[model samples]
Target: MPFVHIELVAGRTVEQKINLVKEVTEAVVKNTDAPSEKVHVILNEMQPENYAVNGELLSQK
Candidate 1:
């Protein structure tokens, strides 16, 4: 089994998530020989207010 974790800023549309999972699954299948059913993909969405860089919140940037 192969597990993948992706952390992204929140607010992506459903379509974007769909495309991301599909494309990532295909890549995992090709590189690891793991079937789609055996590959696990985790999407961690964070709010801009909850993320920061260089002492500045993403929402403030």
Candidate 2:
């Protein structure tokens, strides 16, 4: 089994998220020899205010 964790600022559509996971699963399977069903992808969506860079919150950008 292969575990993949992805974090991003919230706002993407459902279709986009679906495509992201599907593509990610394919990549994992191709590179790690893991079965599609055995690959685990965890997506963590955070609010812009909860993410920051260089002392500035994403929401402020």
Candidate 3:
């Protein structure tokens, strides 16, 4: 079994997240020999206010 965790800023379409999980799971299954049924991919979405970069809050300049 393989567990993959992904974190990103919130605000994405369901289709986008679905495709991302599918593609990531497929990649792991192919590269790591993980069973497709046992592979897990989790996407964690955080609000802009909760994320920061370069010492600046994402929600604020």
Report the number of the highest-lDDT candidate: 2
Candidate 1 lDDT tens digits, 1-61? 7999999999999999999999999999999888889998899999999999899999998
| Total backbone clashes of candidate 3, pairs 3 or more residues apart or in separate chains | 0
TM-score to native of every candidate shown? 0.89, 0.93, 0.93
Error of 2 at 56 (Å): 0.9
**Residue range 1-61, candidate 3, lDDT tens digits:** 6888999998999999989999998899899987999998888999989999999899897
Score residue 59 of candidate 3 by CA lDDT. 89
Candidate 3 backbone collisions, by pair: none
Model-by-model lDDT, in order? Answer: 0.94, 0.95, 0.91
Q: Which stretches of candidate 2 lie over 4 Å from their true place?
A: none
Off by over 4 Å in 1: none
TM-score of 1: 0.89
Which model is ahead, 1 or 2, in terms of TM-score? 2
